[model samples]
Target: MDPLHYRAFTTPSGGGNPAGVVLDASGMTDARMQEIAADLGYSETAFLDPGDGGHFRIRYFSPLAEVDFCGHATVASAVALADRDGAEGHYVFHANVGPIPVEVHSTERGYAATLRSVVPSVAPLDALAELLRVLGWERGDLAPDLPVGVAFAGLSHPVLWAASRARLADLAYDFAAMKDLMIAQGWGTVSLLHRASPDLIHARNAFAVGGVVEDPATGAAAAALGGFLRAHGLLPADGRFTVMQGEDMGQPCRIEVDASGDGGVRVSGTAAPIPVA
Candidate 1:
C-alpha cells in the first residue's frame, strides 16, 4: 500500500502538523498499523478503508497508542483522497469517536477540508488542580478572559488559556513528567492558548501523551477550543476567526474557525500530502 504524508492546516507543504495517510488499508491488522505509526513517529497516522458508496472506515494511531479521533490526520486523508479522486463533495468517515463528515472544496490557495466535529461538550470544573499540576502551570498563569475546562469534540483535551501571548510562545516543560500526568488523566492533548483578539487566537498543543512533544496543528484541539470559546461566551454570534499554530516551531499552520449562533463550530484548513518513506 502507498502511504501519503501530509501537513494539515497550512497552505505551504512544510508547515502544519505532518501525518501519514494510507488511503487504502485493506487487510492491515491493528498491530501492523500500530507498528507503522510508531515507526513513522508522527503525532498520528490515519488508515482509511473505502467502503460502499462514499463512506469510509478510519482509524487513528499514535506512536504509543490508538486514539478515537484525529483532526489533522483526517484532513490529510481527505486531501489525499481528493488528490486522487478530485476535490469536491462530502466524504463520510466512520471513526472510533463516531461518524465524522468532511467537505472538500477547491480554493485559490489549494484543496481545503472543512470538518464537522462529533457532538461536543465542555466539562464543568472537576479536575482543574490536577490538570494544572500536570502542565507545570500555575493557576495564576491562567487568563481571566477564558475559563479553564475540559472540552471534547472527538478526543478529550484540557483547555488552558494563557494570561498572555508571550506565555503561550515560551513553551518549555518536562516531557516525561507531563506524559505521566497525561496518561493518568487520560487526556489526548493539552490546548495551551493565547487570545490575540476577540476573534483571533494563537494555540500550542502538548502531545506528550501521544509520545510526541508537540503537535504543529491540531484539528481536534481546535474543535475543542471552538466549543470551549462558545460555551464560555468568549465568541460572538456569527464569529469567524483564525488560529495561528506551529509558528513557534517554524511550521506555521493556520486553522479557520467559524461559530454559528446555533452553537456548532466549523474548522477549516488545507492538508497537503507528505511523502512517506
Candidate 2:
C-alpha cells in the first residue's frame, strides 16, 4: 500500500504528530497491516476500507500492536479522505470501539478535521498508589482540584493533572516500568496535564503502551480530559479548551477540544502532508 504521511494537530508550517494514512486497505490481512505499521514506525497508522453509504471501516495500528482507536490518526485520516474525495463532506469511520464521525472543512491555512468522539466515561484509577510509585511522583504533585482517574472517549487514558507547569515539564520516567504498568492495566496512554487557565491547558502524554516514548499530539487523551473535567465539575457542561503540547519535545502542537452536555467531546486539528522519504 502506498500510504500518505500527514502531520496531525499541527500548525500550517507542520509541527504536530505524524501519522501514516492508507487511503485504501481493501483486502489486506491483519498481519500485513501490522507489518506495514511496524515498518512505517509512526506512533499510529490508519488503514481504511471504504464501504457503501459513505462509511468506512478504519483500523489503527502502532509499531507494537493494534489500538482500539487513535485520535490523531482519525483526524489525519479524515483530512486525507477529504483531500481525495473533495474537502466539503463528512465521513463516518467505523472504528474498533465505535462509530466516529469526522467532518472536514476548508480552512484558510489548509484543510482541517473535527471528530466527534464516542460517549465518554470516567472511572477512578484502580492502582493510583502503584502508578505514583512507577512515576516516582507523590500524590502531592497532582493538582488538588483536578480529578484523578481513567477517562475513555474511545480508548482509555489515565488523566493526571499536575500542580504546575513545571511539574508537567519535568517528565523523566522509567519507560520499562511504565510500559509494563500500562500494559497490565490496559491503558492507551498516561495523560499529564497542567491547567494554565480556565480555557487553556498544557499536556504531555506518555505513550509507552503504543511502543512510543511520547506523543507530540494526543487527540484521544485530549478528548478524555475534556470529559473528565466535565464529569468532575471542573468545567461546565458546554465547555471548550485549548491544549498546547509537544513543546518540550521541540514539535509544538495545538489541539482544540469542545465538551458537550451529552458527554461527547469534539477534537479539532489541522493536518499537513509530510514529504515522503
Candidate 3:
C-alpha cells in the first residue's frame, strides 16, 4: 500500500518535519519497508500494524536504516490514526523502546498528538571533545550552567545548550565525520539548543545518523531536552516549555513539552496532511 504524507509539528508559518505513514503495513517485509522509506526520502517513516482494542505495533525507518523510536513519525502516525478512526482518541503503540501512550485531540488547525515518552535518563558523554570538534563548537560555546550530556527519552540524543542563540543558528559541521561519530556513540541526533526565556527555547538538531543533515523538528529530542531540564532542576515551576525549532531552516515548528509528572516526559505537536508527489 502507498504511504500517507504529513508534516508533524507544523505551525502557521510553514510545514514542519515531513514523515510518511503507512497506516496498514501488516505483512510488508523489512527490505521493502527500507526501500519505501529510502524512496520517500523523509527523515523517518512509520509502519503500523493495527492490533485489537486501540493498540498498534509500529516500526520506524530512516533513509538508511531502522530507528528504535522516532518522535515526529509517531506524532504523524497518531494524528493519522485520529483522522481515520475518530472513535478512538487514544492509542497504545508498541515500539522497540517500549509502549508509548498517545492522546489525540481535535484542534482548529488540525489534529494534535501528545506522546508520553519512555522514562528518560541522562548521562555524560564519554568523548565530548570529539563530538565538539566535529560540530565546530568549543567548550565556551556551551552554556556553563547546563553541562552537556546524552539524554534518552525514546531515543538517545546528545543535548548541549548553546551559550547564545547565535551559536545555535550557525549550524555548520562535517557530515561524514558527524555520522561516524554518531554511529559510534549510538546516538540518533545531536541536539543544540538555546534558552530564549524561562519558558521558551530555540533548538537545532543534527541528524547525520539518519542520513539527513538536519531534522527541522524533532519530537524525541524535545522530550529528551525536557528530561534533561527536569533532571537538572532547570525547568519552570510547571515543568513545561515551548520549543521553537526549524526556524533556521525557514520551516519553523512548535513543540510543547511537559515533564511535570514523575513518570515520563510528554511531548505535544500538531500534524498537517501533505500531498505526496
Each prediction's whole-model lDDT (CA): 0.85, 0.89, 0.92
- Pairs in clash, predicted candidate 1: 5-274, 6-274
User: Sorted on TM-score, highest at the top, how do the candidates line up?
Assistant: 3, 2, 1
Name the TM-score of candidate 3.
0.98
**Each model's TM-score?**
0.94, 0.96, 0.98
Error in Å for residue 36 of model 3: 0.5
Please state the error at residue 197 of candidate 2 in Å: 0.6
**Which residue runs does candidate 3 get wrong by more than 4 Å?**
none
Q: Write the per-residue lDDT of candidate 2 for residues 1-277, one digit (tens) a residue.
A: 6989999999755599999999899999999999989998999999999998769999999999999889999999998888887656788999998899988998997889999999889998998888888888899999998779999998889888899888888998889999999999989999988998878899999988888899999999999888888888877435988999998898889999998676579999998888876
Error of 1 at 272 (Å): 1.4
Best by lDDT: 3
| Candidate 1 lDDT score at position 197 | 87
Where does model 2 exceed 4 Å of error? Answer: 236-238
Candidate 1 local lDDT, residue 131 = 66
